[model samples]
Target: MATTHADDPGRCPEPLSTPDDFMGGFCAFNFTSGPAAGSFCWDRQPDYSAYRESSFGHGILEVKNETYALWKWHRNQDLYQGAVGDEIYIVREPERCLLKSSIAAYF
Candidate 1:
């Protein structure tokens, strides 16, 4: 689950045992706003080689080479929204993604 940085300063999972190895788990993040506002968790059931975010309304995930896209469902408006190259970070070891004040232009 996602939480404030002051609540849980999570650590990245341990490295895979081998290059071809697979590890399964999850990581909580403290993102600023939006669907991932609080108590957010990312699935790492296969591997941490990629980043992903999903919710009832939308999903943003990495496809390859650190590229990501957003898919949203505007059910009431009967429209689907999508975009590529959304901002995200894949934190590992000695690094962290922290929350800050939201910027109006980002909307």
Candidate 2:
């Protein structure tokens, strides 16, 4: 099981970014802050040929706004499963444009 807190020590002071979406959007943090940091999010539908690696294991980025996007995996079931609820954030400065997940949604 997974659990999170309003005051978790590891939680970011503030989300790197937040956007409006179906899940009412979410709070995003630096990529290095999550367990799946530095990895690619692969999906199939609405394919992205430029980033496509294989048919079975590819991901797609559905940009929601300047600060958020949805990273869907190549699967038929729940698109928001796995990690970070299939949501991602854009981190500028210090991180310099790093795509990351939110602890609020992932943890």
Candidate 3:
């Protein structure tokens, strides 16, 4: 899922939330029977004054066994050329990363 908001500070008082915010809603997709599905999320807020607004971008995710999937984004300004933004790849594996638990819960 994707959402684009204007860069006007008055319009959006809070910082943008990450994709994790939608995780609960995504569980339904995971349970559906079908070819394994992947999820993609994006946010775009362009400064009206600067012509150098966020442009198109693409992503490629490799789910293993050499299989790959790709996604792309194009800014309205580059409608003719179809310019793309930075590319990304997602590699899945059993790994551990530093995680923090809520401190408020312990109080």
Candidate 4:
């Protein structure tokens, strides 16, 4: 459910230095079930160590339904090619997923 949108207004396509220039595109993540099910724009960097690695790629998590989701990683170098990392139909139980409750209650 994530996608890169059109370029930002008045911003040059230069390297990212500050947080303001870090996010070049927009990504949308949708939740298909549970009480907090909804769509949201993930315009921020994740705390995951894998994402912090020195790499030029993007990841997407799409919730197909209540228990099924898809994850994809696209490298910047190979835009014309297919996704470098791809997985589908991942089973996620909302009630049993501890991270879900913790993150939901964090705020």
Candidate 5:
């Protein structure tokens, strides 16, 4: 899950209580049953990694030399949405990818 820093503080999840801005609630859920002829919990956590915002410093995720997939969806013609938006082949050298302890040295 990817998260960003919040502008201001928020009422943290108090004990077992719900968070002031519960990100989980935004995700839709269902109740599937064999007797009913449907499925439940179709869209659950970790399935669609959520990018939530929290009251903390922000930092971007650094993905290097990785195989990633980008996808899109349509209400009607959803079949083709799974097609790759762009095929990316990343090649990052370890030496160039690493950051120096003395950042000013580069300058």
Candidate 6:
């Protein structure tokens, strides 16, 4: 589980109170991957793509990215939403966890 906390370390986070839909100033993602059984990382930033429309029609932003966190909870519910529950990815080798090279011809 992933949650958003305040910059301070002496407070709790608030609960989900979406009356209709969406939150403000908060975004989170739990990464569960590795060579082992329960290795994981809480990534505050996720890989995202940006797009825009100009006189040349639709196009992707090669420099600007709009992916970001967009939710904020009250600083008083850390126990319920702050703790990371369940199992995560188990990593044996740190280098192999993230692919850095492309696959070539294999025999």
Model 2 lDDT tens row, 34-78? 443542221122323253223234457777666666676554243
Clash count for candidate 4 is 0
Q: Could you give candidate 5's per-residue lDDT for residues 1-107 as a string of tens digits?
A: 34422211342223224323445534222345432224322222343445433322223333542543333322322345344333344454344433634333442
Instruction: Give the Cα error of residue 41 in candidate 6, in Å.
Output: 13
Candidate 4: regions farther than 4 A off:
1-55, 94-107
Name the 10 consecutive residues with the lowest summed lDDT in model 1: 14-23
Q: Which stretches of candidate 5 lie over 4 Å from their true place?
A: 1-43, 51-83, 99-107
TM for candidate 1 is: 0.18
- Native-referenced Cα lDDT, model 1: 0.35
Candidate 4 residue-wise lDDT at 32: 59
Write one digit per residue (lDDT tens) for candidate 3, span 37-76.
Answer: 2322112332343443333333344344543434455455
Regions of candidate 2 where Cα sits further than 4 Å from its true position: 1-55, 76-107
10 residues in a row with least lDDT, candidate 3: 34-43
lDDT of 5 at 102: 35
Clashing pairs in 2: 42-58, 42-59, 43-58, 43-59, 43-60
- After superposition, the stretches of candidate 3 with alpha carbons farther than 4 Å from their true spots are 1-71, 95-107
Residues 1-107 of candidate 4 have per-residue lDDT tens digits of 34443222333233232234335553333445443245242233334434343246677888888878888877755757675655656886676666656654432
Model 3, C-alpha of 73: deviation from truth (Å): 2.8
Task: Tell how far residue 17 is off in model 2, in angstroms.
Answer: 38
List, residue by residue over 39-76, the lDDT tens digit for candidate 1.
34332233433342333233354444433333333222
Clashes of each: 4, 5, 3, 0, 2, 17
Model 3 steric clash pairs = 56-73, 56-85, 57-85
Which stretches of candidate 1 lie above 4 Å from their native place? 1-24, 32-38, 41-60, 66-107
Steric clash count of candidate 3? 3
Of the two candidates 1 and 4, the one with more favorable lDDT, higher being better, is 4
Candidates' RMSD to native: 15.3, 19.8, 15.0, 13.4, 17.1, 19.1
Which candidate would rank higher by lDDT, 2 or 5?
Answer: 2
